[model samples]
Target: MATLPVLGGKVFLTDSGGAKHLVKAGCDIFMSTGVTHRLTEILGFAAGFALGFEGKDATHPGQRIKVSEMGTALLGQAVAKPVGSGKGTGLSVIIRKRKNWDDIAWRFTRQDGS
Candidate 1:
């Protein structure tokens, strides 16, 4: 199977025993619209896979809800900012590991006062 070059050598096995590389954290999948709904959708898919939200049981609804809400809020913030205000027009989705989700979310929440 093809693997992303940025993943380097980190690999893991799926339930089906297929080998896959772990996505690099803080990697930016860029697009024309920075933080727009469309961009968020792309980012969400990457986040979901990196965070193990794919083909998983819904036993952890709370964590899922938090991530969803955080994404929404981030989208809103991106939309609210003016396009040419030095923030640039490109959007980058930061992909992180499942283990670091809580700490990352907390930092974002505290930083944004949300």
Candidate 2:
């Protein structure tokens, strides 16, 4: 678990093997696998759901799922896109385990099929 500041205010990534990373921020902390780290702006009631998601390797147990500062603001507003056009307002970060993704994926696949 580590902390690194996110500057661009956005994260876009594709699926890949499991690697560990930490979001270094004073206000918030979260962890996720290298490949699965996804960020989309939180919107609607889904915003609440998004906030509830736990990021892997988070320093605080309660904050398993976390979002950026802009995320919280946009969520409260319940806007689809950011107030000003340009890019989106908030981001949604995908979280995954570093130890073993195949194991988790296979396990869930069985349950889903059942």
Candidate 3:
């Protein structure tokens, strides 16, 4: 097997067998697996938000790196056929709401009318 992509110092989920991996959104595998697997959210990731991901396009191992969009909903869609050979590994990409200190402060202020 090829050396798989690893999302070090990044947010990721662990499988039942204790494998850590990062997957893309809109992938057929993710859609299917998300339904059956109970995914756990990992916290304490680096700053900035990840919006979404595109399928792997490079035929060579090092040719393609996973690309992600920032500051948007994590919605998964089907990847293009040529790019996504359905042979990709990893579980799936997960999207979480990014809340900054300002956002939190404002929410509290509104609730308390302060």
TM-score on alpha carbons, each prediction: 0.17, 0.19, 0.16
Q: Per-residue lDDT for 1-114 in model 1, tens only?
A: 334444354332222234233333354333233246466667766765666533322444334322221222354364443333354432333433566455544111223576
For candidate 2, give the lDDT of residue 57. 32
Lowest-sum lDDT 10-residue window in model 3: 40-49
> Which regions of candidate 1 are displaced past 4 Å?
1-35, 53-114
Q: Count of backbone clashes for each model?
A: 0, 12, 2
- Report how far residue 67 has shifted in candidate 3, in Å: 3.0
What tens-digit string does per-residue lDDT give for candidate 2 at 1-93? 333335845332322256444444443444564234233222333554444443543444544444534322544665454333355534444
lDDT order of candidates, top first: 2, 1, 3
Q: Which of the predicted structures, 1 or 2, would earn the higher lDDT when compared with the native?
A: 2
Model 1 residue 3 lDDT?
Answer: 44
**Which ranges of candidate 3 are over 4 A from the true structure?**
1-65, 68-79, 82-85, 88-91, 100-114
Candidate number with the higher TM-score (1 or 2):
2
Best by TM-score: 2
Candidate 3 similarity to native, TM-score: 0.16
| TM-score pick, better of 2 and 3 | 2
